[model samples]
Target: MQSYVNVRHSAQGHPSGVSVLCVSSELCNRLGACHITMCGTGMQRCTLNVTLEQAMILSRNHGLMPRCIMQTMDIMRKQGPRVELSAKNLKVMDQMTPAFPRLFKLCLPPSDGDL
Candidate 1:
């Protein structure tokens, strides 16, 4: 079996706390997780595979706008080919990227003739 390290926030309190998990592709499928990979500084690759329900909870709990969430997910997915975002999702992602740089790292330029 493939091995991976997962990070989780302490279950005490802090409602807005963040929990991160890192898992390999094989382990991800074995655990029935939907994974999203992100590229960090220094070319480090990070994988996030929080459950869909947990993501929805984070969205609602943190009062995050839908567009912002999509953009953040887009930025994360851009690191690898494992995840696919829909066209409508791309639209929302485009709208949020420029406006919320603090929430996501959108270093990529607009695609094709989006200029």
Candidate 2:
């Protein structure tokens, strides 16, 4: 858990990198924020600060979530908002599972290094 939070936004900078879509923190919701950095070169380093409500929107609409936040959201949905989730307590949910199919597939760098 701390490992993910301590993650830097970038290791090697990339021209086209990870993008953190903006969420409404002021007007819409302001519960919490998640800062995540993807691990790769030629990629963007970003920290997304968003409310819990906004996180749900991203997962529902765009299927995007910072790793830890996603698990937190799952706990919130299942256990209700009053409960808090610890990394040790919250079991990470699989997005691709039959009950929760992913709408988008991750596009990774080529294995052969053709790019």
Clashing pairs in 1: none
Quality of model 1 by C-alpha lDDT: 0.41
Q: Write model 1 residue lDDT over 68-100, tens digit each, in one string.
A: 554455555664432433332457444423343
List candidate 2 segments past 4 Å from native.
1-22, 26-51, 54-66, 81-115
lDDT of 2 at 59: 53
Clashes in predicted model 1: 0
TM-score of each: 0.21, 0.20
- Model 1 CA deviation exceeding 4 Å by range: 1-55, 79-115
* Candidate 2 structure lDDT: 0.38
* Tens-digit lDDT track of model 2 for 1-115: 2222222355575423212223333223355554333343311121122234445566545766556555654455557532332221344432323331232223444466565
Give Cα-based local distance difference scores for all models: 0.41, 0.38
Q: Model 2 Cα displacement at 63 (Å)?
A: 22
Candidate 1 is scored at a TM of 0.21
Q: Report clash pairs, candidate 2.
A: 14-42, 14-43, 17-43, 17-44, 18-44
TM-score of 2: 0.20
